[model samples]
Target: PYHSVAACAGLLRAGGFTELADGAQWKLARGGKYFVSKGGSEIMAFIVGGRFCQPGVESGLSIVGAHTDSPCLRLRPNSKVSGAGMLQVGIQTYGGGLWHTWFDRPLGLAGKVVVREAAPGRPDETRLAEKLVRITDPLMILPNLAIHLQSAEERKAFAVNPETHLQPVLCSKMFDDEAGKEASRPEDAGDARHHAALLEVVAKRLGCAPGDIMDADLCLMDSMPACLAGLYEEFISSPRIDNLLSTWAAVQGLCDFAASSAVADCQDVCIAVSFDHEECGSQSTCGADSNSMSVWLESLLGALEVPPLARPLVYAKSFLLSADCAHGVHPNYAAKHQSEHRPDFHKGIVIKTNANQRYATTALTSALFREVCKKADVPVQDFVVRNDSPCGTTIGPIVSSKLGIRTIDIGAPQWAMHSCRETCASSDARHLRALCGAFFESFRNIDTAAAKM
Candidate 1:
């Protein structure tokens, strides 16, 4: 997660956005237009006018919302703990996760930091925004209880509880034994004391003052890198592919669109945003539910100052593609997915459907996506949550309500979405990129009556 955010920030810098005071946060504007992407691959784009050219012309804000954060366990501040002569670091699951899959994997930590300097009452502040600090030396480990200690029923039914079992080993603390035995040192056993000690440890690692440490949001991720796996190398096994694949594809697509003139009259501003905290509900400043995108879009519109009628025209004409990830049916658990609705890897973009509208993809938007895919010569697939099951969500509906723009929820299908390592097809990345590019270039005046019909 930390590396992905840094990479995204670098991409945004390459596109010319000034980094905001808040470490990884950044913004860029051109004329009356704006484009923003957080940590870099997650993007949200905006435009001011073109309203007069189309009906219901209110605004021309075309949003493509994708999340930068994925499911993973975050190390707690006082994560270090010792048990029965063993040392471990406490971990809390950041989002809904596939808990059992996390056991026994090599893990690393990464996140942004606010460093403080020596000063009584007022510490000097320095933020290491996108700097990912990884402590890979057995920083944590969760050991499973032995089967011999449990009843047959207990052994047969295993459950993972984040408050306990997910903690990782941080190594021995025996070096402190002699110092503690030596004297005037008081016995330390409070959360605050532990937090202070950990903060000091972090400060020492960064060469900053212990007082300089402020607030931080960090997570422990699998030390494993994304790799091509399976027989014949047919799949990609990596951490956070649930949406990173879409984030990468969208960034690649936007870059491609910006460099091409093949699709003309294409002055609709381009944007790519990857907001933070999407794994949980998106209610933060950097989330879809917040004012970040809203404020940014309004500022871009004010800068553009399109003709009054053009605002409405832009809305009537504009579109949004909520690029998220979809679930590929597990062959072993095939009954959990609709047979006809299963999407194959490397095939193309997958149009997701949840009758409850858990997904923002509508009939009209899906058709539009299909048209774009057809025009781009990209193969496409469809996904529907099985009747007996409830599906997870994405950034689609949140952005739709926040911006009030037409949107189609789409993604590349993959397996084990919230696991420590997820899998997907290799070819879908390129195919999705092309489809997104085509959609961006082809967005213009659309027949609403025909669309509605």
Candidate 2:
């Protein structure tokens, strides 16, 4: 939703930054101070620099990166179909989502709409902002096959069909034959009329013309609000916690690092990036693989007038912390993880590594992170993918390759990473915050000579 972006933008603005909107681009920068950007969720990044630089020396940059987008069902452009005399919204799986998890739950729709806004001279250059629409009432439910329909064997052996098993009922409108009769002509009626009717309702709420809307990237979200759950209420049970947990930690760390640096005279820049589309792939413009972060960094360096040759020196001595959510060993699926490699809830930060380089964590990077953690008295842990099991990669490798900086991947332990409602230990959230803060603080103090070696 637009509100979420606004909330994040508010944080950046409050931290002393002037906001800029260049068409669809949303950038917030402090006058010779800090910077943050929402590259339309495919990526989001922020830079904190402009104070604490040696005279005639641009500050070295310390970067933290994460992804903003999560796995969910996306409504296709022509997502209208009729079944059993009722209308349903057609959809396809957006990422590697657990299909069964989406059945029979109350779902809401929210996203951005590319609409034709009032502009002078160039109507083609229409402005863009997020348009969030929610179907608050339970108008749709994906009813699972009844036990009668599925033989005992079939019930246990059935796999979901994205086309058939995931259709969402559009409520009474689907069965309103009298209304359908009044709106049945394709030229004069039918699904188009129905859709138009629905749009009228949506347009009324948005206060815009239906024809003004060009395209949409709508998401079906669980209607449930985030809350504290568990027998002792010691854990956070929320939607999108897999990466949100790390994201919140990263933001907190940047805030803490900036506040701490208020009086220090250090020649280093600190940044926190939360990119989008990581759940699917980091290929979008807002993704870590894209040039969004690079563009911002280069601009800052240019503004600071750093020599091109010295840029490599800054990177060689620089460090990037890739914050993502790591799997905590599940009690039910304990065998899925190696005994020693399994991370515990609220234990400490998890250092994710892959021999195949799926992760950016290497011996050298881990060693540096360990040093920072040690100096801050922060506890740390390690995680390696089970040899036979495929591992999920993060933005760590992408940024490392793009900027040639030493990158380390870290996350808090959590359950149900891609579920609508995910869970994480409350203590782990706070622990990750402390760990990231320490890294941001210590990164500026590391001896460049020693770090390079």
Candidate 3:
């Protein structure tokens, strides 16, 4: 999540965008590009339209939204536990994840850590710090029980109790001997002391004293880097691909749009945003459901000397594309998807729709997106869950309802969405990027087309 924010900020900086203060107001110039971050997890970068600076000239916004957070095992406070001569880290499943896929997988830690910073004026000064700590060559693993230990019925309906089975082993008795009996202390054998030991490890990783580490929000992630797969290298398998793929594509599209010569001709303000906490019902301050996006847009218009009353007019003309990942039909589980709406890998981007507002894709917005994809020379697919199954949602509905903007839900097709590892076609990723770029570049045209219809 931190990487996505940092990467987008880096791209904006490299593209000559000045980073704006969180709530500070400043006048914007025509074609000026600026970015502001909320809670360091949600970021918005915009390129001003040519006519946006003019008074009484209503310019629309072309926006793309995605989320950074993914389903994973989040380490809790006082999380260390010991049993059967092995030290483990206690974890709570953060979202609806395929818990079984995490078994025996190599895991590493990454997240923000709060610490004390020495300040001259404020003796009680404290600030949060970010760190990615890899404890060992093979940091942790949740080993699966042997198949022979289970009955045929049990094997067929295997279910793990996360509280009992998901604890990741951090160390074993063999490692204690290698450390010269350091784990032999009676106090060290206790849970509290085990937690202290874990803190000490974190301190070492941060090059600070244990007491200096105030708190942390670390999560376990697959240690393996994303890479191309398949004999012909047609697939890209990686952790956090569900939404990161969309996040990456949106960032690339924004950067490309900002750098392109087409900005001068574009009549709509192009904005790209990636929020955190979509996995857990977007209720946080930085989530899509929050007022961050609305506040930023209002602030930008205020800085541009536009009257508060006209802001609603601007928003009414805006269009949003909520980009997330869509489930591709698994060959083995084909019955789970609506037969006519089965999305395929490498086929193109998918336009997601739900009769119930689980997705924000309306007929008008979907048509607009289809036109955008048509112009980009990218094919598009449709997705709808089977009648018996419930559909998972994205930031689409939240943002659309929160801001009252015309929105469409779209994403690249992928398999094993919430698994520790997911797969998507490399070509589909490229196609999505092309589609987003076209969406930003031609959304104004699409809006006009929508009006004519």
The candidates, ranked best first by TM-score, are 3, 2, 1
For model 1, the stretches where C-alpha displacement exceeds 4 angstroms are 1-3, 15-34, 37-59, 118-132, 136-138, 175-201, 209-211, 262-264, 307-310, 445-453
Best by TM-score: 3
On residues 1-453, what C-alpha lDDT tens digit does candidate 2 reach at each position? 233455556666676545544233433233234545654563243444544345665456677777667777777887756677766777878777777887778877766666557666777676654565655555557767778988888888778887778877665554455566325435633234235544544565678876556666777777777888888988898777867677667766766666664424546676667877777777886677788778777766655666788777777667888999989889999999977899988788899999888999988788888888787777788899888999999989988999998889998888887876788888888888887777766666554435454
- Indicate which candidate wins on lDDT: 3
Per candidate, the number of residue pairs that clash is 27, 6, 0
TM-score computed on alpha carbons, candidate 3: 0.92
Query: For candidate 2, what is the TM-score?
Result: 0.88
Task: For residues 1-453, write the lDDT of model 1, one tens digit per residue.
Answer: 556656765665575444443233334333223345454323454332233223333224444557788888876765556676655666678888898888877776667665544445546644433234555444455567788888888777787767867777654456445433212223452223233345555666677654555556667777777788988887889988877888777766765665565324444665666676788898776677877776665545444555655555555555778888888778888878888998877778889888787888888888877877877899989999878887878778887776677777889888998888899888887787887667666654332334463
Candidate 3 lDDT, 1-453, residue by residue in tens:
766788789888998888999888777887888889877678888888776635545478889999988999988887868789897888989988999999989887877777665665777785655554554345788899899999998899889888999999888856755774444444534334335556666778888766667677788889888899999999999999988899888878888888888888677789889999999999999998888888888888878777788778788889889999999999999988998999998899999999999999998888888889999999999999888998889898888888888999999999999999999999999998898888888878667656543
How many clashes in candidate 1?
A: 27
Write down the lDDT of every candidate, Cα atoms only: 0.66, 0.70, 0.83
Regions of candidate 3 where Cα sits further than 4 Å from its true position = 53-58, 120-137, 177-197
Q: What C-alpha lDDT, on a 0 to 100 scale, does residue 444 get in candidate 3?
A: 83
